[model samples]
Target: MQCHQTSFTLSTAGRGPLRLTARVAECVRDSGIHTGLCHVFCQHTSASLLITENADPAVLRDLEGHLTRAVPDGDPRYTHDQEGPDDMSAHIRSILTGSGLTVPIRQGRLALGTWQGLFLWEHRAQGHARTLVVTCFGTAAS
Candidate 1:
């Protein structure tokens, strides 16, 4: 069996879904793990990872719109706004989504669907560097 792991940082401009499909696929390609599970984790409380449609941009936009409406900022009910109105809301959005993802690796590539893409959903209003850890382990290619 083969195993490999790595981490990367992404500088987000603001609140939106940043596609990371190619980046993650590069990681899988470098791993040498032909068949296995790749675990991708975001090391942040205000950000998260999600796998969704890559065919159309509207899908991503709608998801973000829904989340934003579901948890608006400046609610005044939240007391943990030291970082700003988005502080608590960011955490809530992350909770609603997730912090990590697991995808299958086949033929040394991510086995994502034809229209599936991995994304880093930044929930904050300001830009910040987000870190992602990718770990893959499995049998070597024959």
Candidate 2:
């Protein structure tokens, strides 16, 4: 058994999904771990990770729109607005989504669905730098 870990930072343009499939794959390849698991984690409370469709932009837009409707900013019921209207909402969005995800590694690469892609979902209204920690564990490739 083998384990490897790495971390990287990404700047989000705010309130959208950023593709991370290729970057994560690089980490997996570097780890030399085959037939294992790759876990990706977001360090921020307001941002989350997702594995969704990467083929069409409309799917992302629609998901974001639905989240906006479900977790609208400045709902008036939230009191943790220390960072402005979007602060609490961002936290809510993160909770609704998640903070990390795990994918399988096969043949020293991510064994994801053909259309699946890893994404960093920024729930804030302003751009900010986000850090991600990726850990890969399994048998080292021969």
What is the overall TM-score of model 1 with all chains considered together? 0.97
Q: What shift in Å separates residue 138 of candidate 1 from its native position after superposition?
A: 0.7
lDDT of 2 at 17: 95
Best by lDDT: 2
Worst window of 10 by summed lDDT in candidate 1:
73-82
TM-score of each predicted structure versus truth: 0.97, 0.99
Screening candidate 2 with a backbone cut-off below 3 angstroms (N, C-alpha, C), the clashing residue pairs are: none
When summed lDDT is taken over every stretch of 10 residues in candidate 2, the lowest stretch is 133-142
lDDT of 2 by residue, 1-142 (tens): 9999999999989899999999999999999898899999999999999999999999999999999999999999999999999999999999999999999999999999999999999999998999999999999867
Candidate 1's displacement at residue 56, Å, is 0.8
What is the per-residue lDDT of model 1 for residues 32-63, given as tens digits with 9 covering 90 to 100? 89999999999999999999999899999899
Prediction 1 global C-alpha lDDT: 0.94
Q: Candidate 2: misplaced stretches above 4 Å?
A: none
RMSD of each: 0.7, 0.6
- List where candidate 1 sits over 4 angstroms from the true fold: none
